[model samples]
Target: MRPVYAISGGVSKFAKSRPDKNYQALVKEAYDYAIKDLEISFPAFTEIVDGSVASYFSDHFSRQLMAAIMAQDYLGLCPKPSHRVEGGGATGGLCFQEAWKSIASGHMEVAAAYGFETMSHVETWKGNEFIALASDVSFDYPVGGFYSGYYAMMVTRHMKEYGTTVEDMAHVSVKNHINAFHNPYAQKRNRYTIQDVRDAPMVAWPLTRLDICVMSDGAAATILASEEGIEKLEKAGAKIPRPLVKVTGIGRGTDAMRMADRPHVDFETFIKDYATDQEKESQETMKYYQKLWDQGTRYPGVHSFRAGRTAGNMAYRHAGIHDPLDELDFVELHDAYTSSEIQTYEDLGLCRYGEGGPFAASGKAFLPGIDYGLKLPDKPVCPVNPSGGLIACGHPVGATGLMQAVFAIWQLQGSIEKHFNDDTLQVKDAQKGAIHSHAGTGTYVTVSILEKE
Candidate 1:
């Protein structure tokens, strides 16, 4: 276990291209924003964590060894202990976990974590190759080289075992896109329809182009300080809130990294341990889905069900979330694909397993009407991705986790603008939000519950 620390940080807008500058420029932009906006000084960094998806892209985009050193040299904070680590796709969120741990363990007073990626320089196929290399080369290379196909394998298994629908996945996409529309920094503001998704050509059978998160080129950075540092700041007349975004928990686990090599038959089985029922449609939908499973083709594969939920569960338990959907105010999810978000909501205890679609259909998320006195309905519906998730925000690979962290901080700080302008207040006393992110096909899932207090 690691002691918790405060996140006093900022990040850059996730985008498809930083045409005006190179990789270092992009890094500098993120760093400068984090420093200036959050009032952090470069010399305050006692440790650093550098995160990127692939070495090939790191070379092409950043053109530097040890991203921490690159950051330190650029900011002239060298000689402070720094290194780099990569956990397949879990790189960015895990890097934040690492920095938080260092500060919590009394190893460092102040730490800096950065995630940068420029996938535009490289062809799409090459990026796929980089992801493939993360798997067992011998097992994965023999099969077809499609990245989406690998996740599609899980989707097929999920559909077969639980009767999850392509429509359900499409619903996730539509919801995320709608949420992203309000996000000024999101790369894709285009709204999508379920019919549009159904009509679009399938990238993988049962999965369409709309189901996938687009390749993005962006960077994000954060500055973390230990309790001592926080106390020092307060003593120096700098105001800092208590219990501010602490890293209450952290965990790491891995299953079959490759899709084909997985032995699991049912996707939901991955999360059976923490499964719960949705009061609304649990029995009927589960039975209907099972009926579909009995009729459909079964292609059992390794899904992120356990890994993703495990990460969230750890964070939730540590953060003392007795009831997530009600206790949590909002979420910035890892919408790498449409299904990822819906399934993640369930995994995070926001809704019952297999009832995410119906829950989403209820239109409880981000309700249309607003009244300051109008309390949330009987069933609490936490807002998802008010910041536009990876699907719309542009999946800048490693920067996503940091992007989410910054968004969480912003929401907690009351800096976020409501999606719709209402004459009157909507939810009473709204202040906190959650941040959820995953790396590489759900190999790593991180959930942080942030509060204003």
Candidate 2:
């Protein structure tokens, strides 16, 4: 895969809102940023793929629905085979996959993939509904099941079963926010404490506003080229960028949309055995509280766990990584919520089941030199989500996955260190990194591994 496709250049910038720029302008901004540092021509790209969701939310958004074609004209990359790829929040990852396939199959020499989303134009409720549309409409949507609520249920169960305290979850938010302070593109850069996270307004029980990712408007783009394409450009007297990172492995998977369809241990037994002090209340009070507990204990989406595990397994197999905690240098996973990040640690094989909370709370997940109380891992088990992930950097749905890829490419290229001088924020001499994205209520999951060439 390294010899087949290389990420030559990439760009990503995000904000809470971009009232001045629409979807096209955002895409153009990222495209320009990506190409500005490279000596590449528009004609050199044989294919173009656009990854966007909710384009209608942009101020001057297109009604044509042909986002890829519209983007080609906007960027002046005319006559090339251009198309749009979408897999809910993993839209950008799918675009990258398509670009890789095009070049790997010998159908194209060089391809460009870009993703954007303009979500701030609409009201918050409307935006929430739009995101909820990605879930199973027949089952999940009708029951008022949004992402936060689904994740809240998962975290609640994790806490009840594994003794994961609220403080453990708050630590995840704290660590990511600390990392975000170093990222210029992050939506929220303010440092926070466990008390602040605990005091924030609750969006869903056990999940506060600060615990979830903010909706944002942003864009990202990446240019991928084959070895033959690089040689062709060089032979034609074109200057090519040196030290491009290669795509070493990629894996994708999907799971059932209905949460109940997934295989999971019956958490009811755990709840019964580990009943909290609430059980000591009066009989009437206990009955009412038990009713509430019963309502909240339903398995939300075990598919999320299964999907991530499946994808990670395939990626590890392809990359020949038997022990992710030992082999990988860093990770940029889908931290849509802090709980998701904790769960991902277990799912991605970074730690054992029921141990993700302790692993994260222990400060092992934080980069080196950051004093967060607990001692860092004896050997750092891949600093997770150093980009602040979707939690603080914002989740623009369509653009999130590509942003992860861009971060990995920069990290592997050793270019991230140039932007931040902090040793904790830098992953020096990083030869391998992995990026993961999950979308559509766990209906789609993608894991991509990159290596420095």
Candidate 3:
């Protein structure tokens, strides 16, 4: 397969209601921003670009189908090969990888990946109800399996199984929101105390409004190309960044939509299958795992995301990441909720299982040079959600993952100060990072490795 590089990326300002722009206009706004960053005219880009992949979570939000074609028309990539991609909240992540495939497979040398969502058309409650339909309607949905309740149940189980506390989860909220406070594109950029998070109105027990991501009307676009494609752009006066962000690896995972249908493996098999040689030999690690198993714990009961683990493992192996905590400089993951952020720390191998709670409070996932006002045990090791993640930036479904990709690219290029106009969220001397996207109650997940080249 050919190597793929992310040439540039852009995002529209994220907000609960972008009343001034329609979905297509939002996409155009992002696309124009990307081209402008590249120092290329949109018309010139139309002539050089090969095709595009449109990403959006649902047609229900727009009340329109084949939304991609409309966006295609708006972007003036008429008659170019194009298609649509969707997978719940992973829509943007999947779209990104799909564009990578297009370039790597020799199908298209230069591909445009864009995602958008106009979720403000419906009332917040109605929008949530529509989102709840992503669950198994035949089983999970009939029982009122909206995301808030489902995520709340999962986090409660996490608390029971791993001693994850509300305080621990609140730290994630505090950290991400503080990180977002510096991000100009983020929706909820206000700084908050841990108590502020806990004091917010409860959506579900122990889960507050401050803990969840808000729906937004926004869009994001990324320009991807092969080696030759990069040269083509350079010849066309595109001021591409040095040490381009390359797509080093990509992985996706899925599980049964119905949580009841999810299966679990026994402890011994689980360890043999999952534990590393070092972990298998560590007496302390073995004892800790054993204690959990002995306490009637199962591998990836609703408390954890098996799909996320699978995706992270695959991407890590593909990228040759042996220790994510030590190797990657940062991670912009789908933090739709604070609890999920902690859960993902374990899933992504930043820490051992059952230690996600402590990881949340450790400051290891925090960006350097930020004053979070919370006492932490460790300095920043691998800063997760440095872009404030979905919890801060707002989740526009399809736009969320692409937004992560854009931020990862920016961080790799050391352009956060230029883009965000605030150097606080920037990771200094960064080399490699990742973007993670998740959908529904762990039904679909995507992880991609991005590195400066």
Candidate 4:
């Protein structure tokens, strides 16, 4: 396989509504940003491109099909081979990896991956109803399994099993919103307090409005190129940024769409058969799993995401990451809600399975030097959601995951300040980072490792 590098990326402003432009123009806006960052003309940069991959969540939202074809024509990539990818919320992440695969498989030297979602076309409730269709129509959707209720149910189980408190979840909200305060592209940039979070209108018992990510209208694009492709672009007057972000590893996992259809393996079998080195490292960690078993806690009952764990495990192995909390500089995961961020910490091996709550409350996953106003016990270990994640940055489904890639590229390129016009959120001396995208009660999850090269 050939090596792949993400040379540049762009994002449109994330907001509840973008009536000024259609989806095609929104995509072009982001694509233009990426090309402009390379100090190259639009036609000049396109001259080196081999093909492209398009990403979007639902035709129901846009009320248009063949969207990718329209985008291809709009971007002037006519007749070049291109396809669209959709996997619930992981659409953009899947698109990114697909573009990488095109290069890695020697099919294309350079590929463009772009994703967008204009959810504001429908009423808020109508949009949610459309999103709920991602679940099993036979069981989950029929029973009114709205996404928030499903997440609320899962987090409640997490609270019951792992002693994860609403306060723990609130800490996550505060941290992410605070981080978004420094991000210019984020949709919700309010620096909220724990009280402010807790006081917000309740959606589901423990999850308030602040704890949930808002649906957004946005687009994101990234350029992936091989060594030859980079040289070709450079020859065409594209000033690619220094410290290129290389795609070292990529992994994905999927599970049953229906929650009840999921199988529950015993904890002992889980640890012995499938656990990774970091997951089963110490006797203390063994005891923790054992205690959960002793209390009749089974593996991956609605409380946890087995798919997320599998994705992280595969990506870490490919990236040669044995100790994620130590080796990686930061992580950008699908934080559809604050609780999921904590749950993902455990999934990604940043913390143990049950410690996700404490991990958030400890401030270990927080960005340091930025006063979150909440008195945190632990210093920063591995900052999660430094771009405010989906909760603060906004969840445009297709654009959400690619937004992560764009931010990761900028972070590794040390251009966060140049992009956001703010240096406060950049991880200091960042060398490697992970971007995780999750979909529908962990039905689909994608994890990729990006590093400076």
Candidate 5:
């Protein structure tokens, strides 16, 4: 909300595993990188907000509640106000929001938002159990409902209703993996094919191993400054950074905790009834589900679609963007799964409802050079997940949202030339971009618009 808040610098280190580095080490690394990148001294920041999760999984790790304080100590930022913020997967974005508020409220002149996670220390199933805690314990846990099941249900319903196919989902994986090839910080760099995705072992029916993002270890940091802080630095003979990206807009939303609480039609029953009676019962069934779909779009998310939609709308309004497909140059979506990315296309108003599958298959979401189809627009409608996204870029829970912000800042500042091609997916003189992030089951969602200034 702060008009004067601008991102001066950012850094990220995302990888499949960082066994040698603990949470504190990762945070220190990211903070050091951000300061070096901005060529600014540590004293420039008056406050710090650390976004992190599950650091106390083992006794060897930092205490659960002391991660932020520990990070501050590691970075030699003592005697300064440093607070920790967590919103499940949306932790980093929320941290950025709080830091922005601090600067805007005149509490701090310069602030830093940093996030990290070290999941490699635990086993895969153990990590899944920990993450599952984010969901409603009474309803979700009783029925063995985790993220995979939630997404599978949504994808299954989408398929039955909208005719989204397996190939369509596979295309999403292919596109993002190709994008990951260009990202040095990405965890999964292997180039993949549609067949490769299809052949991968199934995690949930209709969703395969390739469809899901891997648990990762990573950290990301961003430096923010108010107008006064910038002037102070300049007056102090410091080199003012050029082409900073301002936080133009931000939106947040939440929904019912239980998936069943949200409106949804019995897709299987609807299909069966339609086959049995095409005239009377089938028509009523279709209408009923249509109503459900309408409601779902407004409050969608057994997987957080509602939060994204609400947040995106607020952001679009604040940013004065009437048409997302035409106005925004790039998007960093919460692509914890390939299905989520496709679903986001519709939620973000990039395309008509139920057209997400075809949109991905059209190759318009990928860079210009990668050939999923030659019929793709010379430039994509909006380049989604250019930094490889959560799928290949690594989803380190707390760090993911900030990583997305870092990508947007670098892309807007024209500092990411080595990673991506200048001629391919790059929007010419790009001015604006949006970052979307969500917590468990869409309990929390945040969207932010960044503008080149």
Candidate 6:
């Protein structure tokens, strides 16, 4: 019932890695960009909400969430209310949720939420160990099982049941890489062919190096205000952007922390069973048709907890969207792997449960020749990852959630430049757009839908 609003949002360029800047410096750079990008002066907001997943990794009380504290210091609001939120990869989105609730409840009139993580500063061996440990201890970590292994199990199962092939998996990476080619902020812009993906070095069995999202350093921020606070800011010197991308809904859900702990009848099992069905259909259909629907088949044993779909579904419910496949316009989802994007299409109801691969090949998801132009079957299901996701944009765990929020807001505001447009292109503010995030290996999910007034 409480209406939440965003006045401005911004993000630092997403890179595969940045060794030049330390954690604090990286956050400072992102905060400055957010402030200037929004055209807000130093004295704009009175409260700050910060978050980070790796502050524990950075130093005692030094994760990325410290960005709020850092921003307050930079803004010289030394005594303003500021706090941290920690939800592993979902930290940023949760931070935005908390700030929105604060304003909606009349606790804070104006607030700023910012997040960033410099994962490159940490050693990969230690980081991998830590991430692996975040899963269930007795079942997942004792033997050194990690996300790669866990997802590999799922992929294998899917292949066994669905009869999907490795070629199907290759298409996922190829689709996302081609989309990323137009994004200047993307970490890796090199285009990949289906053959290239098929030939790429395998990371776990079916999944290849290109299938994974690159770990990197980056930050993002958003400023929010209640209607009354906006009036006051405008009365003073701040130039709050008109027509706020208001947060209409927020929803979150949690699954078994580790797949090994998941009940045999749980959603994880359901997805695997579904993948198996897909394989059977592909095998049966491939004999008669060149493509299952329009694409090749994939191999199973690569199941991933799609946090974005779960979160996005919740946000859609709160925002009153019952038919996401038809009603929504564009999306920014966590593409931790190429398969993630394809799976999310099914999970989010954008495509039939196992038809996601064919959906990608339909030339209907994205506008042809336009980079980042993923669409719905007809109009372009609100362009997907227009800014490039973790696959193209680097994955900075603690900062990912907030980065999603920032990117969604930017897309809605038309602040992001479309790479190619000979004609005067105008995207009317999206009536409904969603941000999806996941944390702890898809163990946690959060979705938020934003709309224009």
lDDT of each candidate versus the true structure: 0.62, 0.71, 0.91, 0.92, 0.72, 0.63
Worst 10 residues of 4 by lDDT: 272-281
For 357-440, candidate 6 gives per-residue lDDT tens digits of 666555545534454323324434445665557777777776777777776676666665632222112234556677777666
lDDT of 2 by residue, 1-453 (tens): 335545544545688789787777888887776665455554443233222122112222233466656666787766556777778777777777777777766777767777787777777887888778777899889999788888888788778755677777888898888888888878988788888899999889888888988988888877777887767656654564457688877888787777767654345542342222223234754464355445553332451376777788777777777777778899998888888888888778787556678887776677776655444445455788888888889988777888888888778877776534444577878888999988755668888888876
True lDDT of residue 22, candidate 1: 62
Error of 5 at 377 (Å): 7.0
Q: Which runs of model 1 end up more than 4 angstroms from their true locations?
A: 1-3, 40-68, 234-243, 260-304, 364-380, 418-432
Question: What RMSD does model 4 have?
Answer: 0.9
Top candidate on lDDT is 4
Q: Which ten residues in a row have the lowest lDDT in candidate 3?
A: 272-281
Model 3 error, position 357 (Å) = 0.4
Clashing pairs in 2: none
- Residue-level lDDT of model 3, residues 376-448, one tens digit each, is 9898899999988898899999898999999999999999999999888889999999999999999999999
Give the lowest summed-lDDT range of ten residues in model 6: 51-60
| TM-score comparison, 2 vs 5, better candidate | 5
Q: Compose the digit string of candidate 1's lDDT tens values, residues 340-416.
A: 67667666767655556565544555434422122333343676776667888887776777777776765665545
The lDDT of model 1 is: 0.62
- The ten-residue window of minimal lDDT in model 2 covers 50-59
In angstroms, the error of model 4 at 322 is 0.3
Candidate achieving the largest TM-score: 4
1-453, model 4: which lDDT tens digit per residue? Answer: 999999999999999999999999999999999999989888887777899999999999889998888999999999999999999999999999999999999999989999999999999999999999999888878878898999999999999999999999999999999999999899998988999999999999889999999999999999999999999999999898887889999989898998898878887788975576876788888888888889988878898888898998889898889999999999999999998988898888888888899889998989989999988999998899999999999998989889999999999999999999999999999999999999999999999999998
Better of 3 and 5 by TM-score: 3
lDDT of 5 at 453: 84
**Judged by TM-score relative to the true structure, which candidate is superior, 2 or 3?**
3
Model 5 residue pairs with clashes: none
> What ranges in model 2 sit over 4 Å off?
41-64, 235-242, 265-304, 371-379, 419-424
TM-score for each of the candidates: 0.81, 0.85, 0.98, 0.99, 0.86, 0.81
